[model samples]
Target: MVIYFTNQTGNTTDASVSSFTSIPVLDYTQALSPTTKPKFLAQLRDALINVGFLYLQNPPVSVATQDALTQKGFELFRQPLEKKLEIEMVNSPHFLGYSRLGAEITALKSDHREQFDFATELPAPGPDEPLYRNICGPNQWPDETAIPGFRQATEEYLSEVDALSASFTALIAESLDLPPTAMDGVFDEPQQHKLKLIKYPLPPSDQTSDGAGFQGVGAHKDSGFLTFLLQATPHRGLEVQNKAGEWVSAPPLPNTFVVNIGRALEALTGGVCTATTHRVSLRQEYFIDADGKPLGPRYSFPVFQGVSMDLSAENITLVVPDHIRDLVKDDKVKSDAEATFNKMFKTSIGEGTLVARVTSHQDVGQRWYPDILAKALQGQKDFVSKQ
Candidate 1:
């Protein structure tokens, strides 16, 4: 699939798979300035339609704030194993808490990373409420005495990123040649966004080079609208798959966030905007120092901008222009069979999200929602059998 973009010289150029190497870097501040806004949007449009991933520079969050958040993540990971287990995700019905290494599954395989997940604090749903509403609830935070100021730093970062995501969503609407607020109605009041602090530890020396245990996180498309990832380390583990099924490296850039379109956005845009496949492959080199000593683990913080849980097929109203819709590629890479079940306009967003959560964290599901877990597993098997 070749995507054409107008370059600075006003000349059209094709971004073919062979020519697509690195992720495009777009300055967020440029999108704010009147003179540069047009150029930024053009680049953003191309990035979204073609690569589905880009490095965002000069984002709303300050360097100090990002550094503090990164520091807090490191501190949180350094805590005793017992402390982390105390707030294990298995204990949370909402799936908001710490997850030890290999606790989460992706692509039906264990992801070789430990993570802490949290979202906007909200009260649990009432007994008579729909089952999908169980996804909304307060987060399980670590002990403040053990990690002082960690909560403050994380919340501050989330607040700043929330504003940035909302602003970016508007820009995305404009980029699609729609009204700036065209997609605003899809977001719920007090939007429920999720953030994760992940640490991809070094694989065993013997397994690093082999294909045995290198998956930090298996290839998959994010289920939300957008994902703003802070690659808090100087390692090359993240890889984005192009339309041609080739993996392109997305290395870390200072003061930048690697932003990617998600499935919800793709569905909202009628496939005009893509949700690219990406994964993190663990390698010994990525965690070794120049002196050959281990440099600990690779850390990353990714925040997923959430949409309304009630959003369903009936709620979709935005229509992509004919010219823009023509840009949709026919040869786009397909996601895993299990993931394809989450397509928007087929079921309510909350329903799909709940199934995915229950499938991924079955321990939590078994304890809090055994029935849902069994149904989700059966659903996956049924879907896969048909495919």
Candidate 2:
């Protein structure tokens, strides 16, 4: 159960200070059965409202496909350093390519993980289009000869998960007491989605004095509508923050994806759905061998479900029932300064998305969007000074 407290500003804070142990688990197969759909919806509603995270069992993607995709990840990262650098993220104006370990920053600190970012392959926008239109572009792929079947496997997995995420989103709409098609308008003809293949390496000995080293990915909310994460290793690293400001462990479970709501959904839903902050803090033991030597890196794959770039708060008209709206605190989920820049009403989805990309991957910004990057950096500096 969740507990909430109201501040003097009249905004409610979750304050879920109880022994909130485990993330709720929901079975996807049950959602397909007429007899069990109600129960599934009830469980989903609670998970969406309170935790904003859950373990999804028996999703559309099969275990074999999952294994294939992960195997490709291992192969991709195993390529020689020079070969990996061939498609480095700096080469892509769209920010779609490989990012070296500690190359990406979050919350002003370098994240200690190497990752490859890609999205639904789309052509670059025309020159006369809006600058945010640049976000849609082709990806930098590795040599097919070096990694046989890598592209095929990844594309297949992406296609399967894309369908799954869309169907699941419809279920989310139903759980919110809205028509299943309530969110249909927030998507474009060719929806834009993104995926990441991440590797969190073992921390150096000197950095592990406190047992935990640098952050794998810093504490932040996803900018999309939903995120389906496949934790491809046994190591425990991912953690979710509760309303009480406590970090709860979210370890890998067999044949299940750890799904979470994202900031985009929270904005479109008018705060009816929550988007909790989460981070990955790497522990030495998580990547240590029995002999105390370094083990292999921890791997994970997360697919971010996208929304229409044209969407903005001023145009959003999805109505939340009064009773459901009452369950949420005064439509103020987070009071942080960054939230201001991320709010849909403050900026269009495309602009907000571009700012986040430019800020996180500065190399892409410097190479492709210098002007916007300067403003973004100054804004961040201004926010930090105020804090």
Candidate 3:
């Protein structure tokens, strides 16, 4: 199926397979400026309420900083296989570390990407702590001897991303007409912030030339609060699914980060803001390099932002603004935030995160926490049965 995407500039581009009509590309600099704040907020509100995904141009980080980090990331990934495998993700109980190509699954299919997942450098929880606490621990790192500047560069970049994420979160709250600190509690202490350095190679030669085939990541929704994605390649393959189920290409643009809402945000706002589904796939046309050689690989940095594991501890209540609430009152939206919270608040944030991870990483789930995975899967069945 040929899909047409009309960008913010009204320029239409055609894709051989499914794609969206358009996705918003907003100015992050304007959103942060006091003089342009109101207009920026309005545009952001509209994008969130309608599309759930946006390209944030001119993010707070500097080009030099980004370049340095990207270099370090490339260095880490280019290390000898023996060196890179030292901190394999399977070795960690918290599921933080390296995952080789085809190691992680999406929708039951293996994703053709390799990545290193890092989180906040927090210590292990006490034995008396909750099960979710087990998910928070020190990140696995490569030896400084092998990759000289990798750790420092990554940690610095993570700090910048966290700050940028917080700024966006504030803007998101303001867009909803809520207090700037409204969602602060979710990120107070021991916050769950994950950074992944991912690389996607060209699909197998025998695969169809048509865009219908999956090349890298599969179609999936983010499970946390928000995501900040930095693409290092020129190929366009990140696709966002619209309400009509059509996928829209979100090609990589220089100096911009792709930001999107996640399930937690959707549940919090009663779906007033979208938590759209998206995926990654490199098409055949982008398979060759500038010199006509097979494309080396595609790299991306994605940060997954999550709230405190005990999000239900305070019995958080969401009072959606009348104006916004009325827009999605009908069942046009997939899940009603208020209704969902009223019914599933007990295990929403923590269990939701667990279910998302376990379902996606079958090997990790089976090896690490089989009991918890079993309970979570059963809970999923119960939830589905009710629906």
For each candidate in turn, the TM-score is 0.91, 0.91, 0.89
Error of 3 at 75 (Å): 1.0
Candidate 1 lDDT: 0.82
Which whole-number lDDT from 0 to 100 does residue 301 have in model 3? 89
125-192 per-residue lDDT for model 1 (tens digits): 89998788889898999999999999899889998998999899999988889899899899888888
Q: Candidate 1 has which clashing residue pairs, if any?
A: none
- Please list all clashing residue pairs in model 2, or write none if there are none: none
- True-structure lDDT of candidate 3: 0.77
**Stretches > 4 Å off in candidate 2:** 1-19, 208-213, 288-295, 329-342
Model 1, poorest ten-residue lDDT window?
1-10
- Candidate 2 C-alpha lDDT tens digits along 45-68: 877777888888889998888999
Per-residue lDDT for 265 in model 3?
A: 82
- Give lDDT per model, in order: 0.82, 0.82, 0.77
Q: Which lDDT value does model 1 have at 99?
A: 88
lDDT of 3 by residue, 276-301 (tens): 88888766656676677766788888
Residue 377's lDDT within candidate 2 is 99
Residue 248 CA displacement from its true place in model 1, Å = 0.8
- Scored against the true structure, residue 135 in model 1 reaches a CA lDDT of 91
